[model samples]
Target: MNGQPFQTPVEYLKGVGTARAEVLKKELGVKTLGDLLQHFPFRHIDRTRFYKIKDVQDDLPYVQVIARVTRKEILGEKHTKRLVAQVQDDTGVMELVWFQGIKWVEKNLTAGKAYILFGKPGSFNGKAQMSHPEFDLYGSEAAQRKGNLTLQPVYSSTEKLKQFTLDSKGIQKLVVGLLDQFAREITENLPLYIVNKFKLMARADAYRNFHFPEDANKLAEARHRLKFEELFLLQLKLLKNKVLHTQKFKGAIFDKVGPFFNEFYAHKLPFELTNAQKRVLKEIRQDTQRGVQMNRLLQGDVGSGKTVVALMSMLIAIDNGFQTCIMAPTEILASQHYQTIKSLVGDGFIEVALLTGSVKTKDRKIIHQKLENGELKILIGTHALIEDKVQYQNLGMVVIDEQHRFGVEQRSKLWRKNVIPPHVLVMTATPIPRTLAMTLYGDLDVSVIDELPAGRKPIKTVHLYESSRLRMFGLMKEEIAKGRQIYIVYPLIQESEKLDLKNLMDGFETISREFPLPQYRISVVYGKIKAEEKEYEMQRFVRGETQIMVATTVIEVGVNVPNASVMIIENAERFGLSQLHQLRGRVGRGAEQSYCILMSKDKLSADGRIRLNTMVKTNNGFEIAETDLQLRGPGNIEGTQQSGLLDLKVSDLTTDQELLMLCRKCVEDIFAVDPQLAAPEHQVLNMAFQDKNAGLSWNKIS
Candidate 1:
């Protein structure tokens, strides 16, 4: 194992005990010696500047000062006690306070002694204060540094880790110890040619300098090398998986579009296929015809007619003596899809049924039987489709709607339902940026249906503050006068769920007062409402029985009502851009002109303003998604939280577009020639591609 390179457990390290290692593992996911080494510092502090106490401002993040302690005391009762010390620079004196570890701090603080004090500055009762400041005796190692030579790495540490003396300084010591012992053990993982071409720092030196850099330039180089290496490893894994999958898996070939497809395209088709939809259908049909299993991701903005493309693909499967299923993340969406497909196909065109958690036991058994006997040609459902008892006959393909909601394991379960895994067509309404799409779904071929259906008009979006509630009411009443429905949604954040529910109720009350219930039927829905109740309320709106629906973000994913021409999102600033776009998509489905009114409070953050502005600015989900990625970053993007692929240390998907593209191209170039990386020069690259995430059933996040 090359002297057990990065695999050794942290407990075996010189200074780490079992307790400390456990804390490290729990808090930092640092199970192995390698994890510890790769735990790059969050930031490197340049401890070269000293400021006068008089110059300290509360707005400053941190300030360092050369000061002498003039007074020190412990105050308050035992439980509420704190250690407070006054330190004086030549300009002025500032109070330093420590809430915890007061005894140890009080013991160390000495009056009439000089110290190097550093911490965030704040004002308490118009006097300067520094809380829990880090200090060292003046002229000690920490206080004697000058310029970049004084750069100190600060690792992230949890309170639990701190209890075991495994805070940033403690973690640093362990890393330093490990580096001294095993720095020579890290061999170059990259091919020598590629390394020379990129002029990347050696793997060993990069690891060392990542934790403890020599200078700003070396630190920068080390950071770039590490980021490049991480992206390279990820791309290598994805590209290799693609090659191996193509070679090993066989797909069901639906070579002909037969009666079901022909008949539907001839008479049952609801609308003329947009060019984008037709192009996507062609791509899917081509994938299914190939001997290799098709793994394609279909990206479309809302109302882009992707469902028709998916249905046509399914019809082809039926004609080829195969079965297909569509899995939506929500029951409401699944039901809507069932209704849409049912209406599109007309009566008895093909056998179809809805399966969900609420399905009756007897009906579920019947549906299961139909699926097993190949009587059900198409099944539309939620995650209930993936249950162990739910079997499919000749399951040739599976289409996952809002594919991000399902974990990789669950998706793979559906893929493996057949003797040979079924072809997978993953569809998402949320737009992904080009670079992120490549990184997240690197193994799947992607097709984007960028064009919306004809006769659909872009929903006019406008921003309004709370002061304009009366104006919103006027707009709502005007839309209702035209026999149209309206949707009023509130933010439902977990931390402030009570406030959110209160807001929703208050909105309902306000609307109820404006247009009394006898004159206007209004329905309310939120996460706290019973599932059946929520469904009833949503179905009322869907059926045009309710002129206005008061709800929370639960309506974001599903609940289609084309007649609902107006959507008012209260506290619109609370939502991310993708969410705002999705909410806006609920309207604009009907041919009639639609409107989305963003209602936010006066105090909007810069990003909040950007989000609301973007909604008003464009209907393009891709553009909205790019803006979202830039504002919040990749890690916080909709479905990427659980994706270990985004556990990037230095590389940012938003800003590292150039680097990501370069890495992808380099990997693709190698794969095109080697296919298996069999050459001598490529062996190091192959060897370095260790599956650290092995033994995981849900290996792929996509």
Candidate 2:
């Protein structure tokens, strides 16, 4: 048997018939023998030592005892029914209970039969007992020797699987059967030289040890080998795609820092560029001048002056006699960018236009003419920028703000707008952890601006209970009296049964009653409102017509009010750390001292308490992001699942940062010598890449 044995339908296996195969496919996605082999255990138990029944303590993690079943009884009726068995070792006696599958237990358990019982110990009516424990017959000589097993792998199975006799033990037995039949048929994917260099265990040995380890050392070595293989294959694909992209796609060369960029830095720059910002600009300049398309990610925290760096880079493109564009995710953000860039460039130096869904038909016609006639130097808009009708004359560079909101297909459409894709710069205010960034955006260069501008004060954050409402109101009144604005954000637009948090409408009504009409004006905004109405309310708040904006998370990303000195989040415990940080960023835009009040109920879960305390402790976005990753794991992080790169089976992005770095270094070394993996010794890697990349789509934008 070769690879064909692994590919055989799981229904044909010795223990798995048609009935169990259906349940296995529906419950665990194990359709073929190979799928079953790859379903690694989530945890392992040490079964080498056995404890006496008298020594079993409630606090012990898990213990096994060799005992004889002396009696069995079925109690209760119908759904309330349960089966209990009295088992006695030489020293003491204990009880075993089963609430589910009582009929099966009543039929199988026999009196005067010696068995091995394994489970967590607990007390019931002053007697030791274990509910739903694992058991095996102890009379057989083979079973007696196997009872001293060093390690046992425990897999994840569903209750539905348990009904069909397909629990973790059943799955383990099936894997054991498969291994007995086909372990020797497993082929090596990595070259022997590389395996020797890393001192890795043989591929067959790794599979065997991962399922049934001989000792702790062998288990550790097995895990290391599998994790390295996973990370290495992923990195190899990304690097190969990058190398192929650079060689095939030609970019417009912006070889000179011409008068436009020079003039803006010399005279028009509003503030001195921070060292971090200067370094990022140098990187972008180098990419544009290299004559290859640049796919770079720009990460900066809120209020860190990213827009200024973006404007300066756009000016370089303009100086080289090519057009540029910036696409934001929302209409308000697009309009804000258009106004900011227009003001920065001043009146006659460059022609800039704003194109959005709300733009009038006649105005759009004029903008189109200017864009096609090479008169429009820059165009800024939301998704409207990618429309088929919008054409550009020599579009050189593209900048996307908050790029995660857009899908890969939507962004790739912009690349199709030009003959050769323009140098791409994707910017995000959400700080991603280094491990996550390397895995998600491995094919792109990354630049981060970590420092804030001079003369800026850190926002003061405080956690407040709901009982502190009056004091919070007093502080808001004081800020208002000082001629500043405020934002009061709620978590939901309407009340929900699943969540007991306050909604936007209730908060608006309460704030109105507290502050009254003539003295205080509040604007309400939410997702359900009409687009035109929402924009009108937002504009009113922007012009300072309203002293307070009571809204939902719709205002979390785009709204920027410099005079707003306070951010009050209602039921802050309901939000994640990242969202809380983004909401806190809405304020603290100006020189006035700013504050963020996190209002929550008095009682909170442990994780919720940690999230709130983290916000109150530091204003660093990266630090907050790392804590968020640890608390919520990578799956819950925003926009990460959509990338399709985090479908990891063994390695964890939160804890395996060092392993990921080492894998990257290995790829760099391998590529330095065999860029295409065409050497005879490297043929194994090339074949593996072909199999991995056959169905996978690599649509990274440049």
Candidate 3:
């Protein structure tokens, strides 16, 4: 209370002594008055209305009533003991029970005393009851004022905080106390001109209204203002990072699409390129020729030909007399890329080498020698490529496949391979939605290959219950009769008592029994399997020696078998939408019609139903991605949480996409005039940026 109100610690606040303050800091990350003020409520309740005791229904949400305690009794044994009080209003009576804190309830309750009660109504043996309701003596100052009580904010609390009497209501009381003392001291962070243009509420007013709004409209306006502020700051940071990268980093110029690229495109190319692939390749070529380092993301669906675009981009780099490398998250994927690229560049057009951990010591020495001597035009490997012994001579470009699997530090290692850091092109077959791409990878230029190759049929998706297993078996047999292979994927590698999931080994046994291994061979693969054994199983499936492959999600990436026309996922409800999509992508690589059959129990959760229905409705990856974002929120979606891009407090990427876009546009407008924010009009923004981003790790590679 002595220094600035915003900087005062919570321990100094009224009713929040040192012990409670420590709990607040530990549980909710609220240490100071400013932190308490910013901890906005997840939801609010209208306390202006009250329900009669007779009108209390089991389905009704939180309701308040003025009632008198008619009788009180303690029931049940220890650990299950409870204090029950019969409360009655003019209309009727209802039971209020406290299973926890029974001693406190017993000490506080008095028969014939009037009180205001509030909680969700529940039914106990056909009688209306409320468990652990909030109550205060009627006519007391603590009682909520009827008609004068507007919106009451409910804050989130943890179990530890609850042990110290800091539940939602308790936290709300602390927030109210802090706001009452320091409302005037909460200063604005946005510039006046921007605020006036947007007609935004002042920061102080927004915080106050967010904690306890006078009405619903003011609450909405306050939310909009705060969400805009959060998104605006995030966009400003991302845009600044982009400006820093482009202005400071210089890249090698691949000015020519020379003979190596043209010859492969004309003669050695296996098939015609899709329009989407051509468009993405053109974008990459433009970036490489600009002499500014290209930090681009190549997003495509399972079989949309992202690998071809990456290969062509690498060829462009090699044609410029510079070596290039492709980094995969796993050896299987690296080997796949190396073989595909080598085959596409037939007749030794480019000297390509694989440098995975499995490569022999002598082979590693040869790869190192050739790479240093500039004899290796293209190198492909896993994390082994980042080893200290690996050095590149004039490395011009780096292509990272499934880039989210690697950390920022591991990917940054490739940047140091050259004096002027090599141009980066990170690729993912996981189709990221536009909103997600803008926020998560806003610093990178994104190029998407949206179309699949010609004559490739769309994979038909369906949901099946356990009762339809015989039907599913018949379909599998029919597909195998047509010389097509099949994949049976499970959610777990071993049985777990907690989850009734179909494990991989059990699934392999079931399939072997049904298919009879002498007539039909089945290969099993999972993460626990050795690298050599997994590769052997995968090769067996790829070569069509095995008619079926029983595996876990380890086959979700890198395994390519065009002959595998059907993907059957057991316990599909247990898998996420992204994992389901990735697993489905393992099929439909050839001209024949493919299918993804999702097998689950008869019952499903709402989200599970949405995922199954969505897969059945469309083959478009972007649409599926948008739906996934909505269903899972930003944090649970694959890499956003790990990248720290979704470390947002107020703004939601799913519901606030328009606000995010507006904020990005506003940042662009500001930077157009004051690139460094040195002008007087942008001084507030500069100060706010420093305060927000201080000591933050901004090493994410888009």
Q: Give the Cα-based TM-score of candidate 2 against the true structure.
A: 0.92
- What is the descending TM-score order? 2, 3, 1
Q: Estimate each model's TM-score.
A: 0.84, 0.92, 0.89
Sequence-dependent TM-score of model 1: 0.84
Q: Please, what are the lDDT tens digits per residue for candidate 1 over residues 1-702? A: 123756888899999979888889999989988788878799988666678988999998788888999999889997888888988888987999999988788787789999888889998998999999988888767454322235679999999989999888899889889988988988777889999999999878887887887777888889888889878877888888899989999998888989999999999998899999999999998998888999999999988988899999998989999999999998889998999999899886789999999999999999999999999999999999999999998899899998888987899889878998888999999999988999889988999999998899889999999898888889988899999999888998999988888888888888889989678999998898798888888888888888999988889977788899998998898888988888999999889999999998899899988898888899999999999999998888988877777867678899888998999999999999999899999887767655352111125444
RMSD of 2: 3.3
Q: For candidate 2, write residues 1-702 as lDDT tens digits.
A: 124676688999998999999999998878888778888888889997889999999999899989999999999998888998999989999999999988777887789999878899998999999989877787566564453457888899999999987788888889889998889977777779879999998888888898888898999999888888778777888888778878877888888898989999999988899999999999999999888998899999999989899989988998988889999999888988888888888999889999999899999999999989889989999999999999988788899999989987888888888887888999999999998888888888999999998877999999999899999999999999999999998886345722423356667778999999899999988777899899899999999999999888888888888999999999999999999999999999999999999999999999999999999999999999999999999878887867777767778889888989998888878888988889898888776754432112224212
lDDT of 2 at 648: 75
Write down the worst ten-residue block by lDDT for model 2. Answer: 693-702
Higher-TM-score candidate of 2 and 3: 2
Report lDDT (CA) for all predictions: 0.87, 0.87, 0.86
Task: Candidate 3: give the clashing pairs.
Answer: none
